[model samples]
Every structure is written in structure tokens, then in C-alpha cells.
Target: DHQGKGTTEPGVMHQEPYGSLLPFGLHKGYALATMCEILGGALSGGRTTHDETLVSCHDAIFNCMTTIIVNPEAFDAPAMQQEAEAFLSWVKRSPQSGDAPIQIPGEWEENNRLEREREGIPLDTNSWEKICQAALQAGMPEEELAAFRALAQ
Candidate 1:
């Protein structure tokens, strides 16, 4: 089972999972995510846990694999590479707000993940307090959490 959790700052597309679709076109994204559900559920006879209430709310998950079958030799490899590079260059050259630089798909997200790993996840004070309280309620020793807080400092 692949289980992971991530956080993203507000207004950043990479942090917003469904937000990327706006740039790529929402209809296209809907089609793509829908295709994932169909193939995972219908083709493989696997029920997409995203659709079931208990599974959706709790520990169940679904997986889908999408592949593009491309024959590089059918087209000029160098030409294709050049075209891709050109497109990326154009995107990078777009205007930016203040010190922010234009980034292509996955770039901003990778950078954010790396930065957060180094600096620690950014959570508001209230959320942090809530988490600590929850841990205490869950029977986590107060001394253990206090030690962790000391180390975190």
C-alpha cells in the first residue's frame, strides 16, 4: 500500500493537486482522472476506494497506472528533443511576479518538497497545538512530546 501525506502553501499550483488542471485545461484533467478511475475499477475489476464511503474516509486507497506507448524511431529523436526543449524554454521565459521565477510542471513541487524537508513542514501555531493535544489525548506520553519539542527547537 502506498500511503503518504504532503502539504503545500496556498496559491501554489503544485501544492494544489487539482489546481494543475486549470493550466492544462480542466476538461482534459477531468478526462484523465476519470480514465484512471475507469481503468482501475472497470478494466482491472478493482473497486476504486475513492468511491466507497468507509474506504474513502479511512485506510482504503486505489491505484492507476497510465502509460504512453511511443516509438521514438518513428519520429526524428533530435527533432522531438529540440521541440520539447523549445517549448520548455518558452515557458520559462514567461513573466514572473517579483522575485518568483516561472517554472514548468513538477519543478515547483519538487523544490517545495525539498525545501520543506530541510526546513520542516509549515503549520500554523493553532494546528501545531491541536496536533500536540491530539497526541496527548491518544495517550502519547507528555514527556515524550516535550522531548520532541526540545529537539525540534
Candidate 2:
């Protein structure tokens, strides 16, 4: 949909792509995105990126987000643990049809965490360099950062 190399305009069917940013699943994605912005911005009394140029967002502003925390101990701790275990057991009992066993949402995350805890997390060279840069900015000594660099490998 271009007349030249630099002329990357939208196709005739997709007019003004940047101005009319269409969602992947049409109305469904639009609704979800709208609701998410409403909850994070409107509910928190914070300004949203909507109706503002992208450049304006870099100005002094705090993007709001809501996080819900539940203390299991405050509720029926033992019963909740038992029920959770039972549900996991039931789900795991299902016959595996894929290369990997069926896993609930956070199961792989938990397993990954345990693995990382045992045999430290690996970081790529570029990401490790960025971390070193940030740590230096945060007052970490260059000498101390060398220790972290060793572990990053």
C-alpha cells in the first residue's frame, strides 16, 4: 500500500491508519481497551493517554493502575488451601494431549521461579549492561557491579 519506499500510507480499505487505529477483534477489543483505560485512569482520578498527543505523555504525569491484594490468611486459610490443592490435582489428572502437561495460569510461572531460585536467573548481555547502568545511576559502585556481571552470565 505504497507508491514509494518512504510512502507507507494505509491501503484504500484502511483509511488514515494512525488516526483510525482499529482493534484486532473490532468492537470486542475496543470495549476491553476502553474499560481497562477507564478502570486505570478514571477510577484512580488520573489522566489518560486518550485525546492527547503521544509527545504530551512524556510531561510530568503519573499513570495510575489498580492492584487488588487478597490476604488468604484473613479468610479461611486451611479450607482455601485444600480447595486450591484439590482443583490443581483434578486439573493435572486430565490426560495430556499436547507435548507438555496441562497447566493452570500461574503454574508455569511458579515452576520457573523455583528453577531460577535453585539455578539463578540468566540475563542477556544487553539487558545485563542496562541493569548495570541503572544500578550505577542508583549509586551502586562500579566495583560491586562487577560481581553482578559475573552472576548475569
Candidate 3:
């Protein structure tokens, strides 16, 4: 488990979980997660998750990031753009396994963004009510909340 809820669905791996999640690819995934913890915590001089590092401690969280930056100019491939386009075209040409259309990398998010941009996001009544309640509980002025609610409607 990588401390997340188990699901076969894509695009939901980053969600906060209600329970532990199974690591992808089983042991190999577990190994990758272990390395991430090491690099993001110990190697980066940040604290790893523990009793003292709980999010509830101070209502703020600390994050450590490790990244690799590379310059495209450093590479010798003169036709990199065309090569990448060719590979992506080849992959997209393959038959999909299910009814859902094939999406490459950020395509799903981009599609959703465009749809939301055109249609606006749909929120169920229950969720909207809960958000209002939370704002009130957080000491929002009733008159201000009412103004915002009017705009939302």
C-alpha cells in the first residue's frame, strides 16, 4: 500500500484517501514509493511522515520536492520534435481496448478543463450546502455569505 485508497480508475490517484490504497504494479510500485519517500524526505532534509509530522499538528504541512531539469539543447537529436510527433501518432493510431477514447498524458485534464470552461462545473445540492455550512462555521459573515450565495445561484 502507498497510503492511498485502492482504485483501478485513472486520474484519481492524487486524491486524499479514506483508507489505504494498494500500490500499483505490486512490488515494483512499492519499491518506487519507497524511493520517493527517501528522496523527498531524508535526502531532501525534510521529515518523513510520522506521529510528529501529522497534518493536524499545526494546520500547515511541509513539502519537499526533488526534480531533474534537462535542457533540450543539450541533446544531439535534431529531429526530436518530429520524432516525438511520429511516436505519438503511431500510439494514437492503435485500437483502443474499451469504449473510452484514447487520451495521451494531459489530454484527459485538458478535455475536462475545456468542458468545464464551456459548461461551468456542476455541483450537486448536497455538496453546495455543505460548502456553505463550512464557510459559516469558519466564521464567515452571514451577509457576505449571502452575497456570495446569490452570485453562485
Question: Between 1 and 2, whose TM-score is larger?
Answer: 1
Q: Residue 143 CA error for candidate 2 (Å)? A: 2.5
Per-residue lDDT of 42 in model 2: 73
* Per-residue lDDT of candidate 1, residues 1-153 (tens digit): 022233253343323132322413645776776777677665776665453633354433455454457887897576887898899999889878888788888899999999999998888878888988999999999999998778656
Q: List the residue pairs that clash in candidate 3.
A: 4-20, 4-21
**TM-score-based ranking:** 3, 1, 2
lDDT digits (tens) for residues 21-76 of candidate 2: 45557657888777766777778778665546335653323578866688888875
Off by over 4 Å in 2: 1-84, 136-139
- CA-lDDT, candidates in order: 0.66, 0.70, 0.75
TM-score for all models, in order of appearance: 0.49, 0.43, 0.53
Q: List the lowest-lDDT window of 10 residues for candidate 3.
A: 11-20
TM-score of 2: 0.43
Evaluated with TM-score, which candidate comes out highest?
3
Which regions of candidate 1 deviate over 4 angstroms?
A: 1-78, 95-97
lDDT of 2 at 8: 37
Model 3 misplaced regions, further than 4 Å? 1-66
Per-residue error for 73 in candidate 1, Å, reads: 8.0
Deviation of model 2 at 69, angstroms: 6.7
Give me the candidate number with maximum lDDT.
3
